[model samples]
Target: MITRPRIAAAFAAATLIALTGCGANTGSSTNAAADDFPKKGKSIELIVAFGSGGAVDTASRLVAPILEEELGTNVEVVNKPGAGGQIGYTALASAKPDGYTIGATGSPSVVVSPLDPARGATYTRDSFQPLGRHVVDPAVIAVQPDSPYQTLKELIEAAKANPKSMTASTTGLQTGEHFALAQIQEATGAEFAPVHFAEGDAAAAAAFLGKHVNVLVGDVSGVTDLIKQGKARVLGVMSSERAPSLPDIPTFKESGYEVEASTARGFSAPAGLPDAVAEKLEAAIKTAIEDPTVVKKMEELGLQTSYLSGADYEQYWAGQEAAYKKVMPLVQKKD
Candidate 1:
């Protein structure tokens, strides 16, 4: 019995009310996602760009439990290793910027990957939001126990004489070790044919131990156990000074080479992450990295704990990117 004009007006009112309610609900849900982020029962994924048993993977695993404790949520350490950390880094960059997914980052690998056109990296340094930095492990050059190269000088001399006859193992292309080799070659004319192990230091170490590569160009933490067990003979440590853990080993400078390189590892989330979520993540990471227990564990593994807050970490990476750009042409393959 309703009039046609009255029915139309009622329908319009109903439609307006429904639309308003939907808009309000959407805003509330979004605010809730930011305010109550990392809600209970929700888990965070911590991605490691390297394979298991590598330095990056080890540090991420060690931090995951403490991060979980601080965030009141589950933290899962996921390894997505491949293509010299490109696969994992790509995954991290492409993930939603919800702060629920973060990954371990290292340089000069991460800093230089996107710089190289040949790498075809999808993400640049701006693609990630630096949460915090953890450690800086100095590079080391080692040979098997029975190798004839007794000192770094001997190794350099032999490499210069043989050019590409000597094969060296690197974690991957554009990694710290590769850069170190390029520096050495450019400075001293020593040529070493590098064998890139895209997996990480774990695989590179295995290749050196199995005699597949004549020399191992790796980091101190990656080869500390090998040196202790007398399975590898370290010729030089690529640091400004001798490593405290390896007091007996000398720096490359002391051995008459000016090469020095180290890899710094840290955590980062995809860019555009909510400020609230990012702040919480950065604070939690700072706590975990500064934890005494975590420090002791990292020391035992020969990884030096060097914590840098989110802002400082970003600046540091920017500086590294600038410095490495000058040397990129030196490392490029020559036809």
Candidate 2:
């Protein structure tokens, strides 16, 4: 016995009120869901862009367990080595941005690959979202123990006397080692014969040991064993400060060479990750990098600890890219 118009008005009012209540509930639920997204028991994959036993791979492995402990979840490390880390990096870039798939990328991958178009690389530093930087390992110029060039000055003099006669083995053609070597050469105005090795530090060490190359430009970890065994002698470290592990060795700056370079290893996620998820992942990485276990491992490997959060890391990366752009062209212009 209600009039049709009154009933219709009543229905409209009820519908509007219900819709308003539902909208409020939806917003609250969304905020709650976001707060609970990375719940306990979720798994995170830590991708390494190198083979096992290498510096980046080893560092990632050391950090994974501690990250798992911190996040209260299973953190797994996977190796995807090829194309000077471009292949693994590409894989990381293509992954979902759910904070589940993270990658440990470093110097040459972050700085050099993007600049070297001859390598056919696609992703640049901007392609991935920075999580945090964990470690910095300096490069060193090493020579066989029995080599005639005992000091960095002696080697520079020799290179100046005979351009391209002083063969120097590096990780790859346009790798960090190569960049370091180029920087040193530019600083000193010396020419060194380039011996490119595909297998990285190990092969570079082998080339020096086998008398195939006169010098080897590599990381401290790469030449530590050889130097300890009297198989190689470090000429100069490619850093402003002397390495703590080899306190007796002099830095390039100390040796009168104006050069400073180190390999920075850090974590990153695929591009377009949700801001909330990126925050969670960056927090977890910061925790992982500061963990005692991670610190001990990095110190044992002769790596310096320097952590940078997502935005800060990105800013630092931009500076690095600019530096690479300036330096890479010089390297390419040389013989």
TM-score of each: 0.91, 0.85
Using alpha carbons, what is the TM-score of model 2?
0.85
Clashes of each: 0, 0
Q: Mind giving the per-residue lDDT tens digits that candidate 2 earns over 1-335?
A: 89999999999999999999999999787667556656777788888877677778778888888677666789889887765677788888889877789999787555678677776767777779998998778989887787787789999888888888788887666677778878877889888888776544665677788898888888876777787789989999988788988899999888888988777889999888766677777887898889877787787777768998888888888888888888787556354
lDDT of 1 by residue, 103-160 (tens): 9999998999999898899999999999999999999999999998899999999999
Clashes in model 2: which pairs?
A: none
Please identify model 2 stretches exceeding 4 Å from their true place. 1-42, 333-335
TM-score of 1: 0.91
**Candidate 2 residue-wise lDDT at 257:** 88
Report lDDT per candidate: 0.92, 0.80
Cα lDDT for residue 105, model 1? 98
